[model samples]
Target: MTSQTDGTAPAEEFMDKVFGDYVGANAIFMAAIGDRLGLFKDLAAAGPATSVELAERTRLAERYLREWLDGMAAAGYLTFDANGGRYAMPADHVPVLAEESGTMFMGAAFFDYSTKFGESFHALLEAFRSGEGVRQELYGQEAAEAIERFTAPWFEHQLVPVWLPLMPEVRTTLEVGARVCDVGCGQGRALIKLAQAFPHCELVGLDRYEPAIQAATENARQAGVGDRVRFEMHDGAAGLPGPFDVITTFDVLHDSADPAGLLRAIHDGLKPSGRYVCVDINCADRSQDNVGPMGTVLYGLSLAYCLPVSLARGGAGLGTCGLPEGRLRAMALEAGFAEVRRLPVDDPFNNVYELSL
Candidate 1:
């Protein structure tokens, strides 16, 4: 607590480095260990089990399991019953930490994303500093496949159903046989849904990744929307093939080169009053934990997984994958939107914005 003539050092300054770090930096590592060891969820629904009991039930190494639970208990990731001599996951935290879902859809995958990729975030700062982009070694064809899998099912299962209930505004703006461009559309998921919704709307899914576009085309064909929607290998940064009645970028805007510029291009591509919908998570939603496990992992993915990969071909930084509401609204306004509105979507993990010009 050294006080200087200029000013006194704040308590937060010292405590932040010492004790106030409630979020453990190794939280991802812990999650990975928990998943690998099969420790957390074993005792999750069984109320609580003593370390000895957990070891017996899970046939895990006792001492090692004890240490893990002890650390996890300390971190409030689990609860240890003093008298009952068991550990259990709290109800509030259980759903957030979905363990053992068969297909690796838990928060645990972010650790892999971070370890395999988080360095790019630091490297990105340097790249931005030096006016040189990241190297191309990081993103392979696997990235396109990953994007297809991650976004396709959700778009097919969740988003289309969610938005179908709320497309009066969309229907009003659409003309029969009007051209619809699904910009940055990965695997034509959105277009499939759109084709089904407005059967008469001529739809095209635009993406810079040729592989992605091809996959989207195949998916569109499989989904029976092939004749209605075509996946085009196109560029959003340079421009889009318009004038489109509706331009949709689903979970794609945040990874663009200049999202604002793309919006302008989209605006120009659109007819008089076309709807531009951008679906993504807000990077800076205070309601959600920004630096918490889910947020950081996604941010890392944006840096390593999405941003540079998109830029390697020819695209812009759309909105940092998970940018905030205020920044997104401002970007849309700057892009020459006559009307910009943020529609609250039904996705818990992400938010959707509808910007019209």
Candidate 2:
């Protein structure tokens, strides 16, 4: 290590932060590998075991498994028992790494997000130089599938029970068999859940990505809601068929290149008495104001996915963390919305709004 001379405190501090980030990056990737290979799940289910034992259990190569298990141990993701010559995931950490459908499941998903960023790094570098955004398609199928797994827990647990109940009127409308549309509905998990929850509501899922739309269609068919829920590969800025009783855009509004135009389309497509529901990154308007862990994650995600895709389309780039409530309300108002009411709910990542025309 180089010795720090006088007046080098700032430089030393910066270098230390960089070194820490480097380690963190490697650890995240290793965690993702463990998740992908079902190593964590096996550990959680089978208790402490040697790398050789784990290799046999998972039918994977022992040499790679040994190093991965060591990495997990060094990262404190797993406990090393020298006395027994075995390694195990801590019981408390099991849910966070292995239970994809549960609330505590976050580590694996973040790893997926990190992997996507790495995949797009080259194009993102070009976009940074050109001042243009990376195209959404460049993110590719693996990233898309990873994102679905990442968001599944929230859509599965919170969307219907916690969020929908916040909008009693809209919930009642859906309960009574209203027409519903989900804009930018990536893989259609939300639509499928909604269909299951409210079978009478006619549902439509829309996205510009054909691959995502295809995945959504397949998911709907598998979920046995294909009859009631249909998907379309349509751009939101082009406007939509009219008079949907309830419309939703979850964690997607800020990703739009023309959020105002999309909002206008949403407003115009809704029935006079219809409701528009959306969830976007919960952030302060100013970049400097976005602080703490969640804010850091949001900004990282912005650079990785949201900001680049909007730029790819040569549209308004409202980087993920840029859309604070004030800006959101203004955009909605400009789109002829009568009200932009923030729904009362507690969430770490998203702010829910109920818009009316």
Candidate number of the best lDDT: 2
lDDT of 2 by residue, 1-357 (tens): 555666688888999999998899899989989878888889989988898999889999999999999998899999999999999888799889888789999754587888756768999999889999888887888888887887788788999889888899999998999899999999999999999999898999999999999999999999999999999999988998768999999888888988989999999999999999988888888888898777888888888988999989988889988689999999899889989999887877879999998
Who wins the TM-score comparison?
2
Kindly list the per-residue Cα lDDT of model 1 for residues 1-357, writing each as its tens digit: 466554546655767755544355566567657754566567666567777888888888889888888877887888888888778888766654544332335543343343444445676677667645665444555445445544544565555556644655676655355688888887676788778777888888888767778787887788788887887777786788888877888776767766767777987888876777777765664635577656655665666656665464455643244467777777777888877666656454567767777
Off by over 4 Å in 2: 1-5
The lDDT per prediction is 0.67, 0.89
Clashes of 1: 11
Q: Report the poorest 10 consecutive residues by lDDT, candidate 2.
A: 1-10
Model 1 misplaced stretches (Cα beyond 4 Å)? 1-131, 135-138, 172-177, 285-289, 306-322, 346-348
Local error of candidate 1 at residue 93 (angstroms): 14
TM-score of each: 0.63, 0.96
